[model samples]
Target: MGKHVVCKVSELPPGERKIVTLERRSIGIFNIENSYYALKNVCPHYKAPLCKGVVTGMTLPSKPKEFNWGREGEILRCPWHGWEFDIKTGKSIFDPHKCFVKSYEVTVEEESESVETFEVTVELGAVVVHI
Candidate 1:
């Protein structure tokens, strides 16, 4: 386990993600409005580049084959095939524990910032993602 600095909080806003190479692995760091979540980029199904896939929402089961759309942009779809996984847990919606990708712990920290104009420097805390 190691700490890999991904990006500043301002760099990755909600509905956005960044792929970073750490410890010989490709990890996808996602910003989900209020928090950050990281997942292994490889799809366990067929070794597809999972993070490169589309980020979408989750649908809820309704009455008797009916469905409802919800949790927009909280889901991820594999690029090679249509495999849905929750971004927060890297779990397959159908079988969460059995079929899922690897999830990584993410931490946000404060960083000092330097202003360019007027040579002004301020200790502006930037959001940091650690995996």
Candidate 2:
């Protein structure tokens, strides 16, 4: 596997997604709960950058009998089409088998002198090209 240094871990904030272009490819890195995950930045639905989408989670009904509900922290909604996806697996919530984003491998390395600062590597995964 080839490893490409993307950016420093300090550049990203927790629970946020950042878009970075590597080797002419647009990739997204998400910092969630002290861990990192990478995916293609563009949404499969409309080619919109997924980094611009809203980070959300599973919704639980506020009132079991009522239609109102609250978010639960497992999904992300596409900003352009409102499509939701499982953040951990990049699978579409609406259709599990049919749609998914290309996921990448990420590695974070810390400087020997300090644990507060680190570097990040983003590895490209399966390429998905829409026809």
Index of the highest-lDDT prediction: 1
Query: After best superposition, candidate 2 residue 131: deviation in angstroms?
Result: 36
In TM-score terms, which candidate is top? Answer: 1
lDDT of 1 at 108: 93
User: Tens-digit lDDT track for model 2 on 3-76?
Assistant: 67666777777877778888788887888876888888878988988767888866554655666544444577
- Using Cα atoms with residue i matched to residue i, what is each candidate's TM-score against the true structure? 0.81, 0.70
How far residue 64's Cα lies from its native spot in candidate 2, in Å, is 4.5
Model 1's lDDT to the true fold? 0.88
Candidate 1: tens digits of C-alpha lDDT, residues 67-131: 89998888999999889999988899889979999999998987858653443334456554432
Residue 111 of model 2 has an lDDT of 45
Query: CA shift at 112, candidate 2, in angstroms?
Result: 7.3
For model 1, give the 10-residue run with minimal summed lDDT. 115-124
